[model samples]
Target: MRFLIDFFPIALFVLAYKMADIYTATAVLMAATIVQTGLIYARDRKLQTLHKVTLLLVLVFGALTLFLQDERFIKWKPTVLYASMAIALAAALWIWKKNFLQILLGSQLNLPAPVWARLTIAWIAYFLFMAGINAYVAAYYSTEDWVNFKLWGYVFPVVFIVGQGLYIARFIKDDDDAVEKKP
Candidate 1:
């Protein structure tokens, strides 16, 4: 359910692109993202930083893409977003001596400070990789190829998430183990 909310906009954008063109797809993405944001707020009553950032970027870049009739703006949005995320995470960790991943998910999982630090660094690296890859594809590839990459690039996140889950699993205490220890 949550994944659907997060993904439907991109899916619709691709569908719109297939049926019409990049301009139409941009409009559909803008509208779909707006709807996704509203649905999230309605469900949670508050928006996360990522949600707000995504919404703002979609609206701003989508407007530019449509208004200027340039597909490059839309193509570059993901690169900008990923770069910004990497920068923010790096600055927060190094300059501020804060771990945002810990702040965000610390309550849900119990892990050592070192583990959280490692996870934060991992996320920063992942963002940088994503940003670089997107920039490369957007710059060197045709619009058709970039669009195809957008659809197929879902593999990267899925793999990253699974890898992260595997890493975090070692730290998560099984409920049954806790219960057995309680005796």
Candidate 2:
């Protein structure tokens, strides 16, 4: 349910691209993203920083794609987004001496500071890799190929997320274990 909602825009864009054209797909993506964000805000009563950044980039890049009649702008959006995330994570970890991943998930999982730092660095590296891959695909491939990559390339994130979950499972304290350890 939540997964479908989160991917509504991308799915719509893919469908539109297959049925119509890149311009049409861009328009669909723009509208779908706007609606998706609106629905999220309506349900949550607030928007996260990630949601805000995604929405802003979609609007800006979508507009540029439409105005310029070039698909490159929309194609570059993912690379820009990924690069920004990588930079933000790196800055948070080094300059601010903060692990943003820990800040976001610390309440749910209690991990040591070193573990959190490693997780943060892992995410930074992942983001950088994803950004490079996206840029390479967009620059070297055709529009159709890029669209196909966008749809199929989701496998990378799915694998990364699953691997992260498995890696962190060892650190997560089960309820029974936590209770037994409590004095």
Candidate 3:
């Protein structure tokens, strides 16, 4: 449900682009995203940083895409968004000496502070790489090709993150076992 809600606007944007009639798709994108935001707020009573950022970007970049009739702006949206996240994560580590990623997600999984720091840095790097890759594809690919990549690229990072989580979980399990056996 969460995944579907998150992706609903992007899907509408692509469909609207393909249809390419009266900017109907941008309308759909805006409507869906607004509703998504409302629903999230209703559920949580508070907005997350990511949600606010995504909404702002959608409005700014989506409007540019519609008004300018340039899909490049829309394509670059993901890149900018990812780049911002990467910068934020990096700043949290180097400047603040706090791991926002772990702060956000750590309660679900018990891990050492060092491990969280490492994971946070890895995620920051991943975001930077994703932004670069999005730029590369957006620059070189055809419209349809770029849209397909935007739709499909979502899965690649999820797969990588899950793989990393599984790898870490294995070590965590071993650590737990060792502690349990230590009397």
Best by lDDT: 1
Per-candidate TM-score against the hidden true structure: 0.97, 0.96, 0.85
Q: Write the per-residue lDDT of candidate 1 for residues 1-183, one digit (tens) a residue.
A: 998998899899999999999999999999999999999999999999999999999999999999999999999999999999999999999999999999999989899999999999999999999999999999999988898899999899989999999999998999899999985
lDDT scores in order: 0.95, 0.93, 0.82
Deviating ranges (above 4 Å) for candidate 2: none
What's model 2's lDDT at 67? 100
For model 3 the local lDDT of residue 27 reads 65
Off by over 4 Å in 3: 21-23, 171-183
Clashing pairs in 3: none
lDDT of 2 by residue, 1-183 (tens): 777888789999999999999999999999999999999999889998889999999999999999999999999999999999999999999998888998988988999898899888889899999999999999999999999999999899889989899988898879998799999
Candidate ordering by lDDT (highest first) = 1, 2, 3
